[model samples]
Target: MTANPLDDPFYYLNNFQRVLAWLSQRYADVLSSEEQRFIEDFSALPRGSQGLLVRMVMRKGLRFRHGKLNYGEIGDIGSAVAPLLALGWVDEQAPLGLVELFEVLLKAEILSCLGHLIEQPKARKTEWLQALEGHFSQPQTFRDWCPQLEDRLYSLTVMPLCDRLRLLFFGNLYQDWSEFVLADLGIFTYETVEFSAESRGLRSRQDVDACLFLHDCQQRFEAGEALEEVVAQVNGLTLDNPWLERRRGKLLFQIGQHGERIGDFALALCIYRDCTYPGARLRMIRVLERIGEYALALELGETAAQAPQNAAEAQALFRIVPRLRRKLGGPPVPRSLAREVERLDLHLPRIDPTLSVEYHVQAHLHDDAAPVHYVENSLINSLFGLLCWPAIFAPLPGAFFHPFQRGPVDLLNEDFHERRAELFAACFAELDDGRYRQTILRRYAEKWGVQSPFVFWGALSGELLEQALDCLPPEHLRHWFLRLLLDIKANRAGMPDLIQFWPQRKAYRMIEVKGPGDRLQDNQLRWLEFCHEHQMPVAVCYVQWAEQGA
Candidate 1:
């Protein structure tokens, strides 16, 4: 692959054109009247003009200095920018505020432009901004801001229009024009999944507007805007898309958490009461407890205890319910016994400060017959990813939206496993009859560096892969994979840190290590309990530093 693929001066332009063409083809109905007109008008421009426009759009901000806009392929910048100005897309005289003007100006230019205002010529540009903050509250065109400077500043007027087109193309604002350059340079290799008509992230123009509105609300919330109005607006915006609904829920959850941080229990309680995000109920209970609403906390906690959302909520409720009962002057709730996990205690001399606890444990336990690898969450996840590649990458409707996805759009959605039930069933069935080994081995060879949501290729070496295949039981893999399907968001993590494989005996034991002052986290505890219930070999190893114990 070429170094940049920007080797072709038309690379950025080509990527932009591809996005526009994609929108023209796939998102015709979703495009607004303005967006549609812009697309049509953009197609009619000269190649150089198109290239220049794209270069400007793809850059950081709306404003670009004419001298900085030079591209050898686009020829003269003035000629390229002329057609854009005629269409009012590029405005040479757009009103720029002091802050916006300061962004494009350098230290020397700032000195030249506003030398009289600066008390110190050698002061930093940031300091100069503070020194001249209130002096130029009014906005002005670039020429007026810097009368002595000869360069023209081009401000893109249709940035919002271009942003909508971009949002339509990539399904989100985070993935930008660089995706094309990345793909061209071979930095990323996405699986080629076939798309269906039902695969659009934003299905209709209304959906597009809703998505943009929700995104704006998120920006406002992050910017410390008034809570009530932003929260009300977010709640008011009705969404038909499940994906968009999830985004809304997540944003609301963030607001609720932010409210808690600011000591606004009332606001936090208000947000969490109706918020359907995963951990909102748990947060509501915590807030109730925080504000001395013990009865309310216990009531909700008891309800949640009856049917917890997931293991995470269940674990939290266990601790919360007991405390709430104790606080409410009720009879003491009997605590359930924690399952007995195999324990290993270490007090080895600190030979190296840089090494991790897992590393120390692995080094301490290594032998010719038994070898330990610090697999953590990677090994099992990678194995599952390799064996079930076909099932995971199945091109179902709404699973894949574009060519750039590492995994399905709905990978964490509740129906993710349900939709691919049959596909996953077939993948799991291979494990029962000894065919999975070859399937996994073959996939390991073929899909070595292909992007996968599960596979940690950097962590998984060939030797470890072979060792796992030989030693690990097929039945164990099935249990793990099935549990992963149950609630992928919750179950995928919390795996044991180290795995000691007895290659000779075809045996393995997973170890969860904890350094001094460390204890088992909820997820780690859940994994340990799950392993114990299933009769899988797992242990919790504790390390106490420089103690009297020998």
Candidate 2:
């Protein structure tokens, strides 16, 4: 019945405020007077204005489009920018000449789209400005612009490196440093790589406030800093806002991990006790066992065994607890615990039967046909990539231009939906005319490989795509496509294994393989139901033990 510390909003907000204050002092010499003033005046602004300012600074350009700014969540864009305008930081009525427009297009990375202008290099600045304005003013015309270049217009890369570093940190000042630390530990789930050598050493500010503070901590930790010193530093540092409050448990868990890495098992155990991280109990038990406290480990394991969050945790406890009990010369695991473990063991193996089924189906397929590559995750994502295109091409105003969709958590707003709706309708229209297939093929032909924070493009073979187009029923395609759009995150996984393709006949059939005792998962069942509804040619192939023996 213990209350969560993060339940109070101020828990993170207060910490973020403190970090900003620390940054102001820490980088006093490196930051300009204007930059320092901005930091000092940040907290004094209204919360909405504060957010808007952060958004503006994070954007690529010093000047944002007046038209796009009108639709953001921050009420009264003019009122929000009034303070910034008075500070002489922003130019509200900045003139957009031809040269400025050309630079903007180049920075936005959409210059390629204006090939005619590039070919006619002698085009006047006024002509360039007029062309740019004309392109962006019309929704239909602008929708054709390469979606990837949307955020190019908003980049601050033209700014001095130190200033860019300040903006990067300021935009993410409210984030939990522990989450970044955990990412370094490889425990945080991430879809893309954020930091690179090119990014790190670009600036000349030797004492630049570390843009990624947790990364800096990790480097120091690796250089043999004492566990207590690291802990003291972490305690002294404050960087979090409401968005990061939800990650407090992850932070605590990572701190415990830090202790464990330094061989401070006792310290790690103590930290785990206070950590609300998932699987903390198991982690604590492991630490106890490492310290030869077998009896204590068994006691903790038993409690964990009784109420695990999932089959995986239950299975871990089932395997580890009894072994510890036996090693400590204690009695066997209780009957209830043993049965529960056995049940989980039986079901857990069925959750992802792809590996098992891949081999079985591959062996059965013709040599000319490639067996199911088990890229259901990538195939659906590639299909829905267009949904994110408009956001990429002409990103919403303010801090909404996150190419990787990593920050500014409030991504979806009325404007976002409106744009998505337009894209969705246009996408479906293309689908009806069979242009969507061509687009997917063209995207593949262009070798638009997986770019982190953007769409994941699977290496879909031409043969497979061609066969799929020929064999997959239109009704089934529509059904699954609609379902995927409705819930991209949830629907992306658990697809059937083994798409056996016949190049000779231009045919393909999706096969969901199951071992003798395995059953379909909920997601798998959902896919099957949709296929059945559309009368798609899909089959469930059950491999019996006797058949395997043969």
Candidate 3:
């Protein structure tokens, strides 16, 4: 007897084919006649040619150069291009003009540095290109202009969004839903340093392909497509790549999610077992509980609670498992179970004194007229922002220059720590000479006066700025600099809340205020620890509700 289709290894690919068929039918209204015909033609093409067409459509430029096609899975670049060329989807010898050059540069994020040149009135495209070519020809000029040109060229946006969506969703069938869901699940893996250069390119390409397939399957399942219909399409479909094996768990997790969405709790639970995906176990227990399988749920929950990978997972399982056991009319949790679960509550609300002590202390001092202060996270961080101005707003050489990116792309680089001493030395030199103050004021007046990605900039008031400058310590500033360099994403949040200024003493205190039932999170603890180590004048003020007569 043949193995069940559900147990087949190529089940995923089969499901993908069904989804493609479904998309072709569902998107008939929105897709152009040519697009529909293209889809039909695409289905008829050999799998290799089909994959090549997907890549060509997804590739960066309107025209594909013969030489560039030598890389990646596309065999005999000419053969691949022939079909696409015949279809008129890809042009081999497109003319490059001034407007096209500007658009290409803009997409490449190189336009910002040369924006002034391009924005010149009455400058033709030919003139601009000629000027740009001249600049490129002079080695000294190119070096002085952009040291990172090579890196920038590698990072240019290849496919336009509309084109990507047309290929990805096959014309509005699923739209951006696949990208959203995949991103949410952490499937895209934007951090590229982990993979080899060649693997990085391959993985990125596969990510697009996988997202298209997953999106189709998800849409089909949600649209009430039958399981048999999906399984039948999978009968002979296969993907022979290491990427498929690597993504098997994620694919299974997605299948489980689809199952759950369609109210197939048992199917979801079974798929979750095969998923090996992070958070799958937790999801399985939830599914089991939902389906009235109390005994199995309790058993899995008890086991998971004891050996969870992290404190958060342990805490989550501990919180829910006990409740599950109780609902099942089971005996009270054993002593050993209780002991293991007890550590999970170490950082719980009852033990945290932040809320009670911090908020009340700050509240009582509000009546004192001598020391003027405001509860703000913006003030000090904004001062740090002034120090970061050159690196933050400086038009980077080849960085993906979007209007939204208000900081250096390299700010998140792992090697940024190596440049910390040099960067901060310059910042401190400006601070000591009072140049930073001028720059800060100038920046505030010019660019930052409107809006910025840094939350502190928008909330910075003149009074607060004055207080920050007066109270700022070189050591505390250095600590913040180090913290920001260490990890910009992690360090920016959880700063001290209330900053109180003593104008007479030329001093200020960084106060972390917590209301009743509030606690310091991990990031806040890290900041507080840094302050303590640096001997910075930082305090935690916890509020007592009863003392305040609330």
| Number of the predicted model whose TM-score against the real structure is largest | 1
**Model 3 over residues 1-550: C-alpha lDDT tens digits?**
8554445433333434454564454444444555457667767766545555555544555544344555445467666556655655554334443445355443334454565556554566556666667544422222234444442111122234334334434322333324323433444312111211231111234444544565455567557677545433322234443333334455567667777887978777766775555668888988888888888988998888878844335556866797788889878775343211101111113333554443445445653433445545566567666666555544434222122233444454545446455656777687666777666666665655432334354467676666666667656676676677666655677787766777667777777766557877766766776777677777766554452222
lDDT of 2 by residue, 121-167 (tens): 45665555666574454322122343444432222222343344434
lDDT of each: 0.90, 0.54, 0.54
What TM-score quantifies how close candidate 1 is to the native fold?
A: 0.95
What does candidate 2 score on TM? 0.39
Q: How accurate is candidate 3 locally (lDDT)?
A: 0.54
Q: Give the per-residue lDDT digits (tens) of candidate 1, residues 448-502.
A: 8889999999998989999999999999999999988888888999999999999
**Backbone clashes in model 2:** 9
Clashes of each: 0, 9, 12
> Which model is ahead, 1 or 3, in terms of TM-score?
1
Any runs in candidate 3 off by more than 4 Å, and if so which? 1-364, 367-372, 408-413, 416-425, 449-451, 547-550
Best by lDDT: 1
Rate residue 341 of model 1 by lDDT: 88
Clashing pairs in 2: 59-154, 60-154, 60-155, 60-156, 61-154, 108-152, 147-392, 147-393, 150-393
For model 2 the local lDDT of residue 120 reads 45
